[model samples]
Target chain A: MLDKKLLEVLTSPPDAAVAIVTQGKDGPHVVNSWNSYAQITEDDKILFPAGRMNETEQNIQADNRVKITISNREVQGKSIKGTGFLVIGTAEFAAEGADYDTIKAKFPWARAALAIKVESAEQTL
Target chain B: MLDKKLLEVLTSPPDAAVAIVTQGKDGPHVVNSWNSYAQITEDDKILFPAGRMNETEQNIQADNRVKITISNREVQGKSIKGTGFLVIGTAEFAAEGADYDTIKAKFPWARAALAIKVESAEQTL
Candidate 1:
C-alpha cells in the first residue's frame, strides 16, 4: 500500500513540483510534473499523463527502473510542517489499455499513460 | 547563467519541492529539498545544505553528474500560469572551504555543502 501521508500530500494543495527521475545512457535524467497531476489506481499503482516524456520513455525502453519524488508544503510531517515521499518503481508507458483509458479521461491532452509499479513509497520529510 | 525566471522562483515563496536526482548502482535515486533552501552563489553556482544526504553523497563520489528539477506554481510561465526548470549539472560535496562556509552560515545544521556547477538551466514549463 502507498503511504497514507503521501496520499494526503497528493490530495492537498501542491506546494512543490513532483520530480520523475530516470537513468539515461549518459547520466541520470529528471523531469517535473505537478503533484495533483498524479493519480493512484485502485490497486495502488501510480499514474501520470505523458504529454511529452520522450526522453523518459526512451530511457524506460532501455531500463524500466525509475524514481519519483513528490512533496507538499501544506502537509504535516513526522517532525516538521511539510512532508515529502520518495517512490521507487518500474514504469511503462501505455498508449492503449485500461491505464491509458484512465489517464485520457482526466487529461485529454495525454498521448500516453505512464504507469508505475511501485516497489516502495517511503516518507522522507 | 541561471534562468532569470528560475531565480525569481527560487527567491519567491516556494510552492513546490525541489528534486535532486543522481545515478546509483541500483538505479536512479531521488531526494527532495525545498526550493527556498537553494542559494545562488556569486559564481553562478547553486548551493544546498546537506543535512544527511548519505546516499546522495555516495552517488556523487562515484558520479558527479546530476539532474535537478525545481518549479513554482506562483511563477508565470512562457505559455502557462506555473513554471518549472530542468537543471543539468555536476555536483560536489564540500566539508570545508568558502562554499561550505556559505552554506554553513545559512543552514547551521548542515554538515556539508552540496555545490552544483550548472551546465544548463532550461525552462521546461
Candidate 2:
C-alpha cells in the first residue's frame, strides 16, 4: 500500500504525470499518464481509468507486474527537493463492470478502469 | 535514438526526475533519478552514472533492455501542458573505463558509468 509520502505525491497535482512500466515483447515499455480519472480507495487500491490504452493494456494482460514512479509536486524543505516514489503493483483491467462505471461517471472520457493492488513501495529520499 | 522532442525534455531541467523501468526476477522495477551525472554524446548515446544503483544495475546486466519516461519541465502549449516522453534503450555498465573515468571527473560522486543506446522512443502528447 502507498505510505504517507507516496500519497502526498500522488495527490499533489491532479494532472501530474504517472510513469508506468510494463513488459513488452521487444522489451520493457514505459508510459506517462496525466490520469484525469485516477482514484484511490480507502483500502489503498489504486483505480486508474483506461482511455484508449493499447500497448500498455495488452502488456498488463500478459503480465500484471508493473512499476510506477511520480515526483513530489511540492518542495520538501528549503533545500532542493528530489523526492520521488516507486510503486510495484499488479494491475487488473476492470472492463464494463461496476468499477468501470464509477470511473466513467467520474471521468466521462474513461472507457475502462485499471485497478492496481500494491505489492511494495519505495522512494528516493 | 532520442529525437528532437525527447532531447528537449531530457535537457530541460538539470535535475529533473528520470523515471526508469527494468525487468527483474520477481517483476518490473522502476527507479527515479535526478542524474547530475548524465551525459549525452554527439552520437546520441546516453551516459548515466551508476551511483550505488544495486538492483537497477543488476537488472541491466542480466538484460540490457530498459524504458525511461520523463515529463517536460516547461509548458508546451497555450493552455496547460501535459507533454511527456518515453525512451526505450539498452544499458551497459561501464566500470574502470574511459567513459567511467570521464563520468567520475564530471561527477565525483559517481561510482560507475551506465551507457545507454537508444532503440526506439514514444510519447504521450
Candidate 3:
C-alpha cells in the first residue's frame, strides 16, 4: 500500500524536487535535484525537463527503466517521500508547440523536455 | 537496479532530506522534511527516528506499511531520488542503550524513537 501523505506530496503541483537516474557504462550516473511534475494521463505519467543532451538522458536511452524519487520539507519531524518508476518514451524540443510553449513559459532555461510514463509508484516512510 | 549516484547519496552519511508518511484518520496527513539515514542491517533496512508519539506513528501502528523517500540537492538540473518500503515494528527510548545513545548523540531534540525496517527499495528519476 502507498502512503497517502507521500502520494499527495508527489502529486502536488507547482514545484517538486525530483531525482533522475539512468544506467551508465561504468555504473548508474545520477542527477540530483531537478524540478518535476506529474503528467495527466490514463497511466499517470510524469513530465520534467530533460534539458539539453546530458548523460542522464543517454543512460535512459540505453536502459528505459529509470527511478524517480521525490521529497518535500516540513517544519517538524515529519516529511513525505514518493518513489515511482519512469521510462523515457518521447522527447520534445521546448520550441515545438503548446506543450513545449507552456513548459518554456514556466521554465525558460529548459532547452528540451522528456515525456516519462510512470509504471509503478510507492510511498516511503 | 538503483542508480549508483542516488544510492550513494541516500546511503551517504551526514545530512539527507527524508519524507516519512503514515496513514491518518482524516484522509492522509503529511509531515514534510525530516533528517534521516539508512540503517545498516542484514536485510538492507533503513532506520529513521519516529520521534515521540505523533500522528504519523499512530497511523503506522494501524498499518505497519509505511513509505520513506530520501533526496539530496545538486547544483545542476539533476537530482537523485530513493524510495523504499518501511514497516514499523519496534519503539525504543533514546536513553536505552548504544543504539538509542548513538541516535540521541546525533539528534538531541528527539524524544522517543521508532525503529523502522525497510522491505523493498527503488530509485526514481
Give the winner by lDDT.
Answer: 1
TM-score of each: 0.96, 0.82, 0.44
| Candidate 2 clashing pairs, residues 3+ apart or interchain | none
Better of 1 and 2 by lDDT: 1
Kindly list the per-residue Cα lDDT of model 3 for residues A55-91, writing each as its tens digit.
7667666666555555544311133333232222333
Residue-by-residue lDDT tens digits, candidate 1, B5-120: 98987877755688888889887778878888898999999999999999999999999988888889888999887898888899999999999999999999999999999999
Alpha-carbon runs more than 4 Å astray in model 3 = A1-7, A11-16, A34-43, A74-102, B1-125
| Candidate 2 colliding pairs, count | 0
Error of 3 at B94 (Å): 19
Strongest candidate by TM-score = 1
Across residues B1-125, which tens digit of lDDT does each residue of candidate 2 receive? 45677767666643456777888776677777653345887677777777777898999879888877766646362244646666778888888877787778887888888777888777666
Task: Please write out the lDDT profile of model 1 over residues A1-125, one tens digit for every residue.
Answer: 78788899888985467898888888888888888889899988899999999999999999998888889988999898888888889999999999999999999999999999999888997
Residue ranges of candidate 1 with Cα displaced over 4 Å: none
| Candidate 1 collision pairs | A15-B15, A15-B16, A16-B15, A16-B16, A16-B17
